[model samples]
Target: MALLDLDPRAVATARRLAERAAAPVIDLARRHTTVSLERATLRLAGITGADHTHRAGDVPWVNRVVDTVRAHCGLDHGAALPVFHALAEHGLGTLTDLAEATAAGQVQYRVPTGADAARAEGSARAAIARGLRAVDRNRADRDRLVADLGDPPRRPWLYLIVATGDIDEDVVQAANAARAGADVIAVIRSTGQSLLDYVPEGATHHGFAGTYATEENFRIMRAAMDEVSREVGRYIRVTNYASGLCMSEIAVLAGLRRLDMMLNDSMYGILFRDINPVRTFVDQRFSRQIHARAGIIINTGEDNYLTTDDAVDAAHTVTVSQLLNERFAHEAGLGDHLLGLGHAFEIDPALPDSFRLELAHALLARELFPDAPLKWMPPTKHMTGDVFNGYLLNGFFNLAGALTGQSILLVGMMTEAVATPFLSDRDLALRNVRHVLDAAGGLAEDFRPAPGGLIVKRAHQVLGEAVDLLARIADDGLLNAIAEGTFGLMKRPADQGRGADGVIAKAEGYRNPATDLLDTGGDQ
Candidate 1:
């Protein structure tokens, strides 16, 4: 039901440009492994716990293993082969034992060469097989639980965020949100946690804006959601951040916990958090691989671009980024169903024909990636302190979502810019969404643009603009374009960012068990 007939050549050109833009970055990702990648490998080998000797705070065992392996084996052959080889040869009972031994300065790692490489590879494969089995079980459990409980009541599953800064409090809020009609609950990570090189080890009580995204928090919230799922007769899905410096490591934990969705964008950290471009690209590849194996849908961050740039002028940037994100996700082996591509309704309401333009953008996204579970974001950039106007704006946002056929809709709060939403605020928000959805849900079934109308003109205009921008990106290179402030109006150089030090080129013979496993189709 495309109201505007978008140029097929323009779509094809945009895709080709996106592919060209991503090819070098993908090649670079294949040739390097970051410290986070090494840490994720340690995690997959079943390393857990933290070192208690440091006063700054206990360092994760994965960090210790990665540090030790980097110090001894040089990281070219990856941490897995050396760590697993030590486990096999020293008869270490577990990966934690090896970490403890290394910390005690009693163990030395060797980068196997020649015939010794085969033995190391054999050991690493067996350990990874065990880890993959665990992942498979988690995915199977999620399916079985959803099957027993039943799916959400309708399409465009209502998504709500819980940011209480306390895990226990978040659990209560999450349960309430589920009962209040939220189909998915995303536990927002604490402020600045993305910049942290290491994941916090346990459940944390005090955070500034949101709860710490630790494995214990994930476990506790998941258990509460499971209970609520049975009570509500619907499987309440869990979501958490799998972005930032520790992206790959978070993906490992999220997979183990069976999280249903992850905020896993290709360049979100680079554009918003000033993480190094190369580091984020490499990390996202590994993270998406884990997400793909875990059956987790990855919601990208295209909506954030609209916050920093004008929505009407930058709508094409969203489309361009989606194409790049889609390419990158495909490179990581993610199917369309798992690509939760994000867009938003952030255009200024004062603009004439704003509703028509909104529909054009949403419908264009819907038709372009018909199978993707597009995550439609609510209005935020223009929210004033007036709750009544905010509520009305949200009504329009909800109507657009219903008419455009969004797969997931984040409910907007009337008090968005005023304060952190209260439970009552969330309840009102859900009610607003339900009202619009119930009234206008069938509008899309019969919707069609007036021939050569403003909506049809706008969709084609945006697509043409996107194709032009993608061509420029392909010519200039994505890193250079990003450095020139092309996406979010912020210039972050490729070599200068928060996590630049973590990026490292892979040495010859570099081997990651997870990558090897994924390449060989070991995990399904």
Candidate 2:
């Protein structure tokens, strides 16, 4: 149980920052978010993307394509995907571009297959074509497997985390995860992996938390995991974070190498890690564009907010952040399926209605992102060194995930809140989820709300409070709102966060031949 003891102060600091970061963006993004091809095309044509001085980086182009496609396609995610593949080449310049595009026409797009689009190209048009045709073999496979799930399994799926120092060793661990019944496997990045400005090259053997996020590392892990999926005869999702100085590059690598999900958030870097808000936002905008085009699902870090704050009192903050994140993601051309919004069971279990409270929050998240996959995280805030208590908490968390019907259930470890989990520990965690789901698989089906059922009433209560908070955030500047600590107790100034300069404003002239190639014909 000593393995689960993490310093709570750092987590609390993150919560405070999350509040500051999300409050400002909720309303502004909802009101102004749009897709545009170029700045000059706005209705208020002469108005400014001024305060949004931060660059759109790859967003401008992605917005353009989605906008154009929307004009011609339908409103659903499936309708918009194909066009997204087309516009990703242009790259997104800013959120305004995306909002305008959304208002234009519905874009009809598809989940890209390598055969439809090409790879990176020499010309702009060619690059777009190439990126589309280059099929995401792995993604396609995963989607197929998920689609074929026919009926929900007897229980909720068990998701596991793997962070061995070596990719080869990690592969074995991943296989073991699949064999042990893990439905998803997330490869934790090495400590400080996000802070690196450029992506490291080659396979790595020494990682502090997990493994180096090299292209090779991504590819090797994905392939190994796929093998396990085949061996287990069940779909297995793979995950890695697309957050940091190299966000876009990491996304490009993830898509190229066939990753299933990415830990991609719009403001986490700035609020928690001191990464420049502008830089991270800019980087994230591009990465999400790539994610949209690649048909990759991105899990936002809202749950991480509670790691720092009281889960019960801060529940509204989590909901508010999810709203902001949802709007931001949609602006980037990502769809509901692509939004893996995060939440957790971190409230101290001391409260009489604690379990019901967790259920309310989880259900609220699920209802909001009805089409998206909600990622339910395990308890970290209250996990003591007692393994006995730890496992029981994990069981309750697992039950909560199933009852709330979370799409991605990140299993809680008996050794959580302390050191990284040992492989044996991971196995026990997996078994716990499997057992809960197997027994209670039909609980949701049997569930019916009373005139004012505790779960429904509490969930509604949180929503009403969130609506008020969101309205206030919408009126004040989103950035200013964040500074007021709207998310967790954490408060961060938009302009004051780290990595601002790391954001590239897409110099009046910018180009990447390799990126161009991938955009055009690299899919093959």
lDDT of 2 by residue, 200-256 (tens): 657889998788887788888877866766676666778898887667667777776
Write the residue-wise lDDT of candidate 1 on 297-366 in tens digits: 9999999999999999999999999999999999898999999999999999998989999999999899
Candidate 2 CA-lDDT value: 0.64
Which of the numbered candidates is closest to the native, going by highest TM-score?
1
- Stretches > 4 Å off in candidate 2: 1-132, 135-155, 506-524
Q: Number of clashes in every candidate structure?
A: 0, 86
Best by lDDT: 1
Q: Each candidate: what lDDT?
A: 0.91, 0.64
**Which consecutive 10 residues in model 2 have the weakest lDDT in total?**
37-46
